[model samples]
Structure formats: C-alpha cells, structure tokens
Target: MTAVEYEENESKLMRKAKENPFVPAGILGCFAIVAYRLMKMKNRGDTKMSVHLIHMRVAAQGFVVGAMTLGVVYSMYKEYVLQPAAAQKALEQKTALEK
Candidate 1:
C-alpha cells in the first residue's frame, strides 16, 4: 500500500483505540464506590450476616464489572489491532504469491 494509505490506516486504528474510552473508567469508578460503601458499612458495626451479604454483593458486582470491562477491552483491541495486523500479513503473503 502507499505511504499515505498506511498512515491513514494507522490513524484509524488509533481512533478506534480512543473511541468509547470512558466505559472502562466508569466501570472502575463504580467498583471503587461499591467497595468503599461496603467497607463503611462493615466499619459501622453492621451485623455479621448483613456485612457478609454486602461483601457478597460487592464481590459479585466487581466480578461482573471486571469481566465486562475485560471483554470490551479485549474485543476492541483484537478487532482494531490484532485483526488488522493479521489481515495485513495475509495480504502481504497473497501479494508476494501474486508477484
């Protein structure tokens, strides 16, 4: 490909990386708030069972949020970065064969 096309492709990939960037940050913020609230409840002499339930809920929420964030990041990275690299390699090989 031409130099201009290569630069444009790189710019597109960077844009994809920056797109929807706030989602993971928001997820992490929610997790932090939930954890802090849970800690505060425990510190205020809440019942053991209630504390345990709160802990469980916080853990569940954290796990779900973590999984979702990871999934989104991985999918975006794979789609924008890894897939393009692989496709470029394949195209190069195909062009080499044609020549």
Candidate 2:
C-alpha cells in the first residue's frame, strides 16, 4: 500500500473537529478570554506591571493545559468505554442472527 501523507492527516483532524464540535469551541473560548484580558490591561511598566504580566502568562498556560487535559480524557473515554460497548452490541446482534 502507498504511504499516506500530511494532507490525509489534516483531513482526519478536520473530520474529528466535525465529529466533536465542542473541542474547537472550547479552545476558541480560552483564546478569547486571554485576548480580552491582555487588551484590557493598563499601560504600565513598573514592577507591578511585570508581576501582572507574569500572572497573565501563567493563567494563559494553565488554560491551555486544562483544555488539552479535557480533550485527552474525553478521547480516552470514547475509545475505552463507548467503542467497546458499541462493538459488543454489534457482536451480540451478529451472534443472535447466526443462531
């Protein structure tokens, strides 16, 4: 078989986004919050400004990490819990039909 390339991978990602709409929406919401906070900050350059900037950086990083963690957990639940349950139901139907 021929090897698949990057476009194929990109399409797969698009397909996932289509399947799970909330994942992208949550990411966008996180970015919007960060942008709003940054835009609303006062024009200052003293120590307080430095500390405030650091806090914003940390908050943005935490938001990104939280989004990633939620995505991973949701993916794990779908793969381990939902897929098996669907497969088992299909198998049961097939066995019943054969009998």
Candidate with top TM-score is: 2
TM-score of each: 0.48, 0.69
Candidate lDDT values, in order:
0.67, 0.72
Q: What is the model-wide C-alpha lDDT for candidate 1?
A: 0.67
In model 2, which runs have C-alpha deviations exceeding 4 angstroms? 1-26, 43-47
Model 2: clashing residue pairs?
Answer: none
Candidate maximizing lDDT: 2
- Candidate 1: the clashing residue pairs are none
Worst 10 residues of 2 by lDDT: 1-10
In the range 1-99, model 2's lDDT, one tens digit per residue, is: 223234554666576575555567566767877787678576545648667778777777777677777777877898899999999999999999999
Q: Determine the backbone clash count of candidate 1.
A: 0
